[model samples]
Target: MRPPSRSSLILFAAVLLAGCASTSSTQTTPGSVPMTQDSTPLVGTDWRLVSAPGTRAGATLSGAGAATLRFEADRFSMRGPCNRHTGAWSRSGDQLRFGGEGGAVAGTKMLCPPEIMARETALLAAMQQPLTMEFEGPFLRLVAGDGSAWRFDSRDLPPAEGRERIVQVAGQRVPCTGAAPMLCLQIRTQPGAAWQAHYGEIEGFDWQVGVEYVIRVREYTVQDPPADGSSLRWVLEEVLERSP
Candidate 1:
């Protein structure tokens, strides 16, 4: 058999080089990690912002009024320092996108204080950017393309089927006018709110006059009651603290 001609050899070499280039293009490059198949760690988790570009380190939604992100299926909802906003969200590999103009966020239109409104604005702006996610144990960090980063801590939600809700409340005792003159706990749900009378009494709690208390109570709805009676019952779970 005769050896291949010089032109034939050149043609074969070109085809071999082209094939190599095509295969290289399809393979993962150096330092590039393939996308993970399991997104279980991210979904169904409640993430509370702990740090952000302009916010203090270890900041919390509850500590700074209220801000939280709950992801479910293809959507997400957040309660900012003042208002609640929700929009669609999608994930591709490590990239996450929050809906923007075409997928505008709809929220409650409650007028809030200037400071709270400002925080909400900043948070909304951050959500509009494209983010890359990283998970570290119970913490999740999102870094935007612009170098803005947000760190969040995981907070597992309680079972939804139960009718009871346990919460911490800060309040004082005040005189209340009822069928019989009585004392009521004047509680404030958030900061900078006027103290309002909580007509319901804390079961198993012995109220001391003129004292303030930060207490945890289990509130449950009454199955049936008198038409003029309160439908919710507050049972003292624990006394967090007491003050004058």
Candidate 2:
């Protein structure tokens, strides 16, 4: 058998750990959550994430904040949510069992703002209940009975218009540097290749980087940007580049 993906492990751990701290004051209403009709076990079908009410602590959500869940006979894979997570699963009556503590999930270590992290923490804590799943049209509704819900479907993104070369910025690259810990890289947008950006916590502060590459130095400044005020300034202590 093949090994499980890292994201899957993390998702499993996060979900499990989220359940560890159960003293949060939030009380769940006592009632039976409606389950989807027993057409077939959703464990072998592909489902896409439509909406995630709660967020995570240290990560960036991709696109409109949606993800995909591909459920195998004994395992599953979740794509989107800015990361891919998968692992084994089991079902007992109405209770679903995602791979317990043994599974692993690889995720971005980058931290999010404190407030956002709190929300994510709450969501994780909310995942402790006997979750419920129902079919909402083409989407699957995943509810943890703690007021948190997620939607999924099966749809692939459209392909790019044409083939293009990936250009490297010669002098436009900014080395992210400062006391704050972040894998920051500032690169000026080039022709054809518009800057794609994603930035969350900076100097332990909340900063938004739209398109990941298109640098908006002004926005960083209003929120108390680097004291030096260098638009082209960035620091990436850890960076992984894929070869073409």
Candidate 3:
């Protein structure tokens, strides 16, 4: 095509830019519309803290403990570095508020290292404050009134997929009374649950008798079948805690 005169080219460029601007204004960008409290994707989703105010860029939960949050059914559960906290949550537009008489932000009594405790305290304090939430794709940003910002990644698992369950067990090895008797890991799924003999080996865990352990295990179904075999399997995901 022939080159346009300087003025003509400038006018054409201005028109093109204006058209582009108009198109952009009309088109809805992903996450451009703010989500309402009741319709927010934050509910029933898990978020792993990626960054926080006063932290270095790209800061994450790389220490001994994880900083995570899960919002479900008007309540929130958070694991801050060391302690686990739970409370009620309410949102109005972009503002999120935490705590009420019975649903105050309460944390576990477990003591952690000074540094971890400090970080946990900071995170808990931020949650207690009212914050504005913004979503960018799978990422979420929360900004507090004090100008502090927190970042989290949307870590929602598939609907069909099962989640890992963490259970504290008073570990012991017992003999499996089967056709071929073998040693098995005796585990308690919960505090009040009876101890059951687990025949399958938990990967990444070196089981020891008489030791207390907090273990994360993923439950899934197996297709193949064996005589007197259970379809459910519990694969170890992590060892959160262990004590003699």
Candidate 4:
């Protein structure tokens, strides 16, 4: 049997830990929070970091934010270096908030690289207050009170009209270094070729993790772009085959 995904393990652990905490606590648990209209976009969603302003994305030592934030029911967990930090969360209007022990996550610690350790500390501190939220399709950006924003996507991305090619897409998305810690597709040009992480968009195609695909794509040179941006663009022309 295949192993469970990181998300499944984190979720299972979160659920088990949350249940234990609730039963063991003597303090009054907050009453059932009424569903808020503003939270519809976030609830039951798993957001992976696409970029962050303060801490560098793809930084092995760069710290400043959680790579993944999952909202399940009224509770959530943010994946960190030392631990998976779990907390209570709520949204109202333009703000989303977290609840924790004494304004910090409660957990045993592990030693990591000094820089990573420090970033983890800063990341937890940043979450102590409320953050504003924005969304565009599969992408979601959460901005802290200090304007240190974290951008995430749980996929817009037009078709290209240049040279066409056939590629095979893997069944899973891997963590890649793009502008940030990216959840990207693994694709290869030849049948026996090693898969390479694709950080660009596949225009006009809806690609899902755990689904393998053979596709036709058009490639073109990107016009003037930022120094760090991709020089070439690939747009989806046709999906030749899909395997569940």
Top candidate, metric lDDT: 3
- Residues 1-244, candidate 4: write the lDDT tens digits: 1122211112223222221211213322322332343343565666766565544344321122235777766567777643567767555555666664313234434443333355566666666666677776677777887777777776321242467666778888888886677777888876556789887778777888678776657788889966756888887654545665
Largest TM-score belongs to which candidate? 3
lDDT of 1: 0.55
Clashing pairs in 3: none
Number of clashing pairs, model 4? 1
Steric overlap count per candidate = 0, 28, 0, 1
| Cα-based lDDT for every prediction | 0.55, 0.39, 0.60, 0.58
Output the TM-score of candidate 1.
0.46
For model 3, how big is the CA root-mean-square deviation?
Answer: 21.5
Model 4 has an lDDT value of 0.58
For residues 29-141, write the lDDT of model 1, one tens digit per residue.
22233246433356666787766655444333343335678776656787665566666666556666676322455676554434445666776666665578787767777
Query: Per-residue CA lDDT of candidate 3, range 1-244, in tens?
Result: 1122210101111111010011112322222334743244776667887776555453335334467788776568887666667766666566666665325666665554344556667766776666788887788888877887877887643353655566555556777865488877777655555678775766556777777676657778778947656667776655555655
In order of appearance, the predictions have TM-scores of: 0.46, 0.41, 0.47, 0.42
Quote the positional error of residue 23 for candidate 3 in Å.
Answer: 41
Model 1 pairs whose backbones collide: none
Q: For candidate 3, give the lDDT of residue 126.
A: 71
Q: Which prediction has more favorable TM-score, 1 or 4?
A: 1
Q: How far off is residue 66 in model 1, in Å?
A: 2.5
